[model samples]
Each structure stands twice: as C-alpha cells, then as structure tokens.
Target chain A: MSETKVFGMTPTWRRDVHTHYCPGCTHGVAHRLVCEAIDELGIRDEAIGIAPVGCAVLIHQYMDLDFIEAAHGRAPAVAYGIKAVRPDKIVFTYQGDGDLASIGMGEIVHAVNRAWPLTVVFINNAIYGMTGGQMAPTTLLGQKATTCLSGRTAEANGYPVRMCELLATLEGPAYIERVALSKPQHILKAKAAIKKAFENQVNNKGFSFIEVLSTCPTNWGLRPVEACQWLEENMIPYYPLGVFKDFE
Target chain B: MAKGRVEVREEFCKSCGLCVAACPKKVLRISDSINPRGYRPAEQFQDGCIACGICARTCPDVVLTVYRIDE
Candidate 1:
C-alpha cells in the first residue's frame, strides 16, 4: 500500500485464480486481453462469452462472466444464437485456430456473412496445442508438429490459412485485425484491438474479429522467451499483423 | 528510491522468466526459492525501477501487481 496505488493489481473483469495455461503460453496473454477488454469497456455485466474447443475450452473457469460452452468450432453459431435472441447483451466468441478456421469454419463464415453483431477473439497459435501438438489448419508451412515431425510440406500439408485476410474478403464484417502477443508493445496494441472489438458491439457496429497470433511454448518445445521470439521471427512474417479491415 | 514498485504473488508465478526478459531496467531476477510448483519465482531488484509496468503487461500469468510510489 504505497504511491496511492495508481495501477496494476488484477483487473476486476477476471477472477483472481491460478490459471492452467502453460508457463509463457500466450493464451495467458490473450485471456487477459479478453478479460481486460470486458472490464475496460464496462460491459462485464451484459457481456456473454462463447468459448468453443481447444485449450481455452475451460476458460469459463477463469473468467467471471457468463459463458456458453459450445462444441469445438461452433462458438460462432453459439454467439449467433445468443445475440439473435438477446440483442441487448454483448456477445463474443473466444476460439482457437483449429476451432475457428477448420472444424467451425462454416459457422464462422455464415455468422460473418449474416453480419452478426458479435466480437470474435480468434487465438491462432498455429499448431493444435490441446491435442498433443497436431498440425492445425493455420500451421505454418515447414513448421514441425507432432503430426509433422519433419516439418510441414506443401504437398503433404497444404498451406497456412490467413483468417483475417479471408474474413476481410467477406462483405459483412465491420472490423478485422490480426495482432500478436509477442511483446509488451504488441500486447498493448492487441488490447486496443480487443477493446475496440467490444466497443464496436456496444455501438452496434456489426461484426468484429481479432485474430491473435499466440504462442504455445510447452507444445512448441521451446522456452517461453524463445517461443515469443519464434513468433516474432516466423509467424509475424506470414500472418502480417495489422488491421485488415476497419470499422467503416 | 524507485518511483514505482512491483509486488509478485509468488505462489502464482510459473517462473517463465518473461518478466525478467521484459524488464527494461533489469530489476527482476528469478529467485532461488522454489514454490510448491517447483519453479523459481521472480524477485524485484534493488532500486532503478521506473514503474513502467512493462513487466506487468508482458507477464502471461497475472502474478505481478505494479504500483506507482508517491513522494
């Protein structure tokens, strides 16, 4: 209790609990951003978060707000259902790459195409972190995972899918951005993007999606610091961070 | 005399060392004490801290609580 206690002591949006995320895993960073965005916007009371499959499936345990657990890759659909009936409440989906880009791809496309007034936090860590590091739809080409021990090959594994770019091409989205959590500066920007996504809904600005390039150090087989460096070095180049579309 | 200070909830820290790396002032170091989780938590170095909160923001686990010290 000193210095008048100006800042930093666990935001009110999240419960003060020990998280299950691996040490240095960017899912921790991404989770805090979501929680902070909700608290910062003062929408915690009316916000409903839909978390689908992957590592964040149990995020409901961490966040204090109401959460709807959707089937893997079906968070968009769940978000749509909630927003459709209770339009007054803010609805968002926190999903991983495998859930958002692969299995639940159709749900997301349809929800965006329909212009659902929802905020989507897409955590893209490339490899499938929850299932022993399998190759995900967003897995970087030449990146190695348990499923691709020798590195992902073009002929065998195809190519990485850019979610922000793909969704930007759609006619319905109000905002689309791809941000990363590699450093403090980038995390600050990511926080801004997430807050903006929620703000868009509060202002009735149609659909918003933020694709966060996160790190999975435990699965990636790298130290936490090295994984962050790896993301900045490799993922940033291919994913190309920035706003793909604005809230126009 | 530091302008700001940080308090680490040691039990919650995973000893990932991200905070140590992110600290621009080099004021944090992984401690020798091992928690029940078997990881060394970071400790604040003596003085020289600007209370920039970069270490707090960069932490994956919400373990660090940064505060600005008054006069």
Candidate 2:
C-alpha cells in the first residue's frame, strides 16, 4: 500500500491552546485565517496582532504571536502607534463592529486616512457577542438584538453601517474586501481576502481592511447551522459581499 | 486504494455539527459522548472520506484534520 498525504494540521502560527469562543462562532475561523496568512507570509515573528475588547479579546490565547490588548475601540490607534515605530513589522488589528463602527469610528477613520501600513480584520457579526448580543453599528435592519428587543427598525435604531463602503470612500486605503463565513465556498474567498490584506501590509501598502461577516448562533437563538443560514438570508443581503476597493 | 481519514481534536471540538453537514462523503457524525468541554465532538463513522477538505474548511473551531493513506 502506498501512503498518501492529503491535508496538513493547524497552522504553526496558531497555538495549540483551546479557544474560549462558543461553538459555531466564526471568530475561530477568522483567527485561523489570520494565522494561515501569517504562516504563509513567513512573518510569524514579525507579525504583531492588536486584540480588541470584544469576543476576540482573548485571541492571544489561541495565536502564538506577539499580541497587544487594546481598550475598547482603540485597536486601530494602538496598531498605528506600533506600526509607526516599527515600520518593518507587520501590524494588524482584530476588531468587531461595536469596537470599530461605534466608539472607534474616529480612530479608524483617521488612521486609514493617514495611510498607515497595517491591516485590519473587521469581524461584523451584526450583534455584539461579548456584550450579550447587543445591537451593534453593523446590525442589520429588522434584526433582533438584546438592545433592540423588537428587532431593529430604521426609524428607531437608524441604519446599519456599511464599513467597507465607508472606508473605500477615503483615499488612503490600499485594499478593502468584505467576505462571509457562512459556507465552504464563502470561507475560501474569505481566506483569500484575508491573505491579500496581510500581503498588502507586507508590501508596504497602506491601510488594508478585510471585513468578515460572521455568525453568532447562541445570541441569535438559532442552532449553529440555522445561524449560518440566517446570516446568508438576512445579513448578506444588507451587508453584501465583495471587494469594495483594491488598489493592487 | 487511497483512503482518507479524519482526526478530530476531541478536546477542542465544540461539536456544533457543521463538519458533519459539510462532509461530502457523509463519514462524520456527532458522537453520543461529550468531551472535557462538555460538548459532543464529531467522530468519523465510516471510511470513505475523499479528503475533500470541505469539512475542515467549514469547521469554525479548526478541530478536524484530514489525512490520506493507502490501504
């Protein structure tokens, strides 16, 4: 019998430690993509990840790399400071909708406008998973969240923010793409987008942003499988999925 | 013939069943038993896996690894 090699195990950049994210949460998928990018780019030592104050706050536990914890909505600013001093290093931020589109809006906008050589992994699960499924700035209209008990209404909660479109408007960003984790096909595209974001930083490109539409099953009151379907049927239409901007 | 096998990191799997739904060969299933995390992990119930890797890609936890061996 001949031995066949089919697949490789986890990426070296990912730690062997167990993750604390709930079952079916896409945060783990996003984390794995980032680690795969780092390993593929041969930047494991030069990569510095800035963790946000959301569900991914404990990202340092899963990724074996240099990571810094930033206060709520301050990851972009913190990443900017790190990249400014160590221009040779690959710096990136993992932020959620609440942390990025809400209080950190100004910081992200200014940083992207400044064209810093850094990457941003934006996880837009619509609702804030860490804070008990509260409505976030990216929550779709008519979506149900703890803060919006009766589903989000345009008249009441205003419209959900389209971050990729918003950032693409600025002249500083070199790349911007939005991908989803609802299915295998979508996941492959998501990995490509994430890899490109990291590659942009490696090439000294300025302000690469990859927004990932993820699932939060526990808070959505749906089974893990149902949440993926919900994200496809409801969230994808509102957020859409594509590259908003790519200078390369 | 070359056969594909899957190794589930039992301790890390949350047993959300996404992989079970994703396997094209239908070789995986959620185990009746629970892991240390108190979640049921997906187990390989058959030996016809093609190592398509769809399951690993679809797994949110990155707990499953697929390998091919000749028999």
Candidate 3:
C-alpha cells in the first residue's frame, strides 16, 4: 500500500517526548493548541505554560514553551504568580476538570476574582481520565465512571459544576467560552478560542478561560469516534458552547 | 503522473511513531538519531507514498501536510 501514509507529522516540537495519554484522549489536541498558540503568537521565546496535575502533568514535556508543573488544582495560582512578576511574558494554564473544579476551585476563583492577566485552558471530560476514571466535578448527571458505576447520584455525589457559567458570574474575566475538540469543525473553533485567550493575556487583559468539553474514550468505555458522538449528544446539551462573557 | 507533496514540519513533530506504526504503506520511519530536543524525527520514503493524510492525522503535532499536485 503505497498510500501517502509515510512518516509522522514533522517535529513541530519533538518526538521522544511521547505523551502518556490514552488513545483518543483530547489532551494531545490541547497540547497542539498550546504549541500553535505559542507559534502563532510568536511568543515561544517569551511564553510560560503552567501545567496542572490530573493527566496533563507532563504538558511541560510536549510544549516548547517554558513550562512549570503546578501542584494539583494550583495552576491558576502559579500562573498568577508568574504573570505578576513577568508581566511582559504570556502565561497560560492547562487544567483538567478534577484539577480545576474540584480541589483547585478556591485558587482558580480567587485568581479570576482578582482579574489576573492569565488564561486558563480547562479540559472537561466529565470524568477523571488519569486516575482510573473516577467521577469528576464536571461529570454529568447519570453519567457513569469507575467510581460511579451505578451512575452519579446528586443526593450523595453532588451536582456537576458548570465552569463556564460559574466563571461568567465574575465580571472581571476578559473572555470566557466553552468548546470541544471532538470533530474537525469544533477543533477549529477550539483553536480560535484558545488562541484568543492567549492573545487576551498578551493584551494585559483580565482572566480568560476556555473550557473544552473533551473526550476520553478509554475512560468512558467507548471507541474514540463513539466517545466524540457521546460528547456531542449528551454533553453538549448540558454544557453548550458560546461566549459566556467578553470584556472589551 | 500527478504527485502529492508530503511535507513534514520537523518542528511540530512529537515523534511517538503512531503514524509510522499505523501506516499500512510502511513509508514512515523514525530516525536513529535524536534532535536538539532529544526526540527522533520521522523519515519518509516518498517513493512508496500514496498521498494519504493518515500520517498527518496520526501525528499529534499536526506537522505533516499531504499536498495533492495536479498533473
């Protein structure tokens, strides 16, 4: 088969820094966005990326930007610290649902409240992908994960946190949007939002957050394509994508 | 004969070999040596290619482009 299936995508970064994500996980898509944003912003030299725990811990390895690995749920705080000192450099935090909405909520809320010049790329797959698919704060009602085999019950487990809506309540954020990377069209929109969030940082704007409702097929127990479909059908309704709030 | 150009932008590659491993055409290979970032760059056998974008999709970096040239 002499099909044009030769070689990997040439090194936009490096080859050896292999990702630890499961097949079909959208973390890779998110990583590429960070790289593309840095490349497009021409800030590869002056960009600082803060990677949070919960599956995105190794983001430092994939992105070419100067990366700092933050403690679980503390990326926003670290990002705030960096942006405060190096105000000239662009700073962004890539976080997952558990890391953002769960233990790190206090830090993130305070940071956004203070209107820090930082961007947050939050990945919401509804379940914890790295730690064996536990129920995450963003997990939809009735959704099943390893910890919620019988499905999530609000009486015991609490409600799914709508981050876009939650963050929108704060008037200081410069931009807020929810997007997905499940398909080509959605991926393009996600790229635009991600890039814009970074650009907001460069413009010395207040906090910007783009929540990406991503797919984790391996954790969700669906095929890669099916996972995307599940997201489109079940997840999109609960977490609709749109501009939550934008500041001029 | 029309030839499609498969451009691999080395800067975007993470070189996990998913494409090299997934390609049924076996036109992709990882170099023995590593780059400045300590990752191996993928090598292409253009003669054996059929201009499929599978490698590009499999590539996490989105670094490979398959250009279909009109004859």
- Per prediction, fnat is 0.69, 0.73, 0.10
Error of 2 at A202 (Å): 0.8
Separately for all candidates shown, the number of backbone clashes (residues 3 or more apart, or on different chains) is 1, 0, 20
TM-score of chain B of each: 0.93, 0.91, 0.77
The per-model DockQ list reads 0.67, 0.69, 0.13
User: How many steric clashes does model 2 contain?
Assistant: 0
Off by over 4 Å in 2: A2-5, A13-15
Local lDDT at A134 for model 2: 92
Docking class of 1: medium
Worst 10 residues of 1 chain A by lDDT: A4-13
Best candidate, DockQ: 2
Q: With candidate 3 superimposed using the best TM-score fit, by how many Å does residue A187's alpha carbon deviate from the native?
A: 0.3
Please give, for residues B1-71, the per-residue lDDT of candidate 1 as tens digits: 45888899898899999999999989999999998788899999678778888998988888888888777
Model 2 residue B37 distance off true place after TM-score fit, in angstroms: 1.9
Selected candidate, larger lDDT, 2 vs 3: 2
